[model samples]
Target chain A: MIRVQSEAFDAGAELNAFSTQAAGAGAVVSFTGVVRDVTGGLSGMEIEHYEGMTEKALGAIRADAMQRWELADSLVIHRFGRLEVGEVIMMVATASKHRKDAFEAAEFLMDYLKSRAPFWKKEITADGADWVASKDEDEDALSRW
Target chain B: MQVLYFAWVRERIGVPREEVETSAVTVNDLVVELRAREERYDAAFADTSALRVALDQELAEFDAPLSGVREVAFFPPMTGG
Candidate 1:
């Protein structure tokens, strides 16, 4: 499953729901990204996403993960729009018969989500706002898989 | 066809989307036509390397043909997640 929306979601609830859905799986791994104030003076973060393209990109990535890993099920839920510090930005969960597959798939999903998806983040602070630039490390990480 | 911009690209162009009529054959050609329109477009498209393009919601190269593409989007490298 893949979801892109502006509303916030409960990560615990989502994880539980996904685990329940992947009933017979022996292992499940999940990652949740939080809105952290990297800069102390930060007030909030504004996330802008391509409405029609966001879903499409996420779906493609999810499908790719499913194909590459021995997984029973997967879930990706990402939120957009104005978000305050400490809020959940996104989450990814993968279920498989073994711990290795679940762990690898979750990491793979996060790596792709960081660069491939069509979403931009703007850090808002007392001074003003600035668009978050793509890090070289993020791009370099893709070469592994 | 429709042209769309996002993030700082939209800020520079002053619009999120627009309808375009062009005889351009490829994504690069369409970009050149847009750049010739005004200073804002020119600035937004100043460096192709700093931007990414999509055709009909799928990512595409600048040299990709636009023969039947109905939508073209330009924006910076995504900083998602």
Candidate 2:
């Protein structure tokens, strides 16, 4: 499952849901991305995404993850709109028979989402607000995998 | 067609939303269609090098055809969390 939402989500609650859905899986790995107080010297963040298109882009990311890993189940949730620091901004859950598959799949999904998804984030700092672009390193990380 | 902009592309284009009509059939063709409209569009698309596109909300390649697509979006590489 994949979602692009505007409201915050409970990581524990979502993990429970994923575990419940992955009845036959032996391992589950998940990651929750939160709004950090600092990024590349920026103090805050504001995320923006095209509503209808965000969903489509995230779905493709999820589909690719499934194809790349032998995952029994997976879920991806991303929050849009204004977000305060320390709030949950995104989550990815992957379940497989072994921890390696689950962990690597989740990380791979996050890397692709960070670079290829349609969502854009703007950094708001003491100086000014500026739109954040995917870095060359970020792209290289995905390409290397 | 509905043309939407996101991130810095929206700021550079000076608008978040717009409606356009064109006979272009692919994402690249559509870029050409928008570029021909005015200088602002040309400037916005000046460097396709830094841009990416989506058709009907899904990430798509420049060669992807646009037939029956309801929405087209253009933005730089994502910085998603």
Candidate 3:
């Protein structure tokens, strides 16, 4: 499953729902990304995404992960628009028969989402608003898979 | 063709999307035409290395041929996840 919405979502509820759907799987791994105020200067973050392409890209990434791993099920929910600090921005859940497959698939989903997805984040601060630049490390992370 | 820009590229270009008529055969060729049109486009495309392009919503190289492409989008490297 893949979702791209402007409304906020409950990560815990989403995880539970995904786990329930993957009942046959013995291991379920999940990851949630929160809007962190690392510098304490961030008032909020604005996520911009291609309206038509965001879902398509996410679905492709999830499909790729499923193909590489023995995943029973997978879910990805990414929120857009204005998000305050500590708000949940996105989550990925993967269920597999083994712990390694579940964990690795979740990581793979994240790695691809970081760069391949069309979303862009802007940090709002008292000083000024600035778009977050892509990190070299994030691009390098894809080489592992 | 429909041309789109996102994030900083949109900010710099001063528009989110527009219709463009061009004889350019590649993404880079289109960039050159856009850059020649106005100061904003020139500034937005000053450094091609800082930008990424998509042909019909799929990631594409600047040198990729533009034939049959209905939509083209240009934006900075994504900061997602």
Maximum-DockQ candidate: 1
Task: Give the alpha carbon lDDT tens digit for every residue of B1-81 in model 3.
Answer: 999999999999888999999989999999999999999999999999999999999999999999999999999999888
Report residue A83 deviation for candidate 3 (angstroms). 0.1
In angstroms, the error of model 3 at B48 is 0.5
For candidate 3, what is the DockQ-based docking class?
high
lDDT, model 3, position A111: 96
User: lDDT by residue for model 3 over A108-139, one digit each (tens)?
Assistant: 99999999999999999999999998999999
- Point out where model 2 deviates above 4 Å: A20-24, A39-43, B25-29, B63-69
The residue-by-residue lDDT of candidate 2 on A42-140, one tens digit each, is 566788887766677778778888888899989999988878777898999999998888999999988988887777888787889888767898889
| Residue A5 displacement in candidate 1 (angstroms) | 1.1
Instruction: State candidate 2's TM-score.
Output: 0.85
- Write out the backbone clash pairs for model 1: none
| Model 1 Cα shift for residue A61 (angstroms) | 0.6
* TM values, all candidates: 0.98, 0.85, 0.99
Predicted complex 2: DockQ: 0.75
Worst 10 residues of 1 chain A by lDDT: A35-44
* Better by lDDT, candidate 2 or 1: 1
Q: For all the candidates, what are their Cα RMSDs to the real structure?
A: 0.7, 2.5, 0.6
For the second chain of model 2, what is the TM-score against the true structure's chain B? 0.91
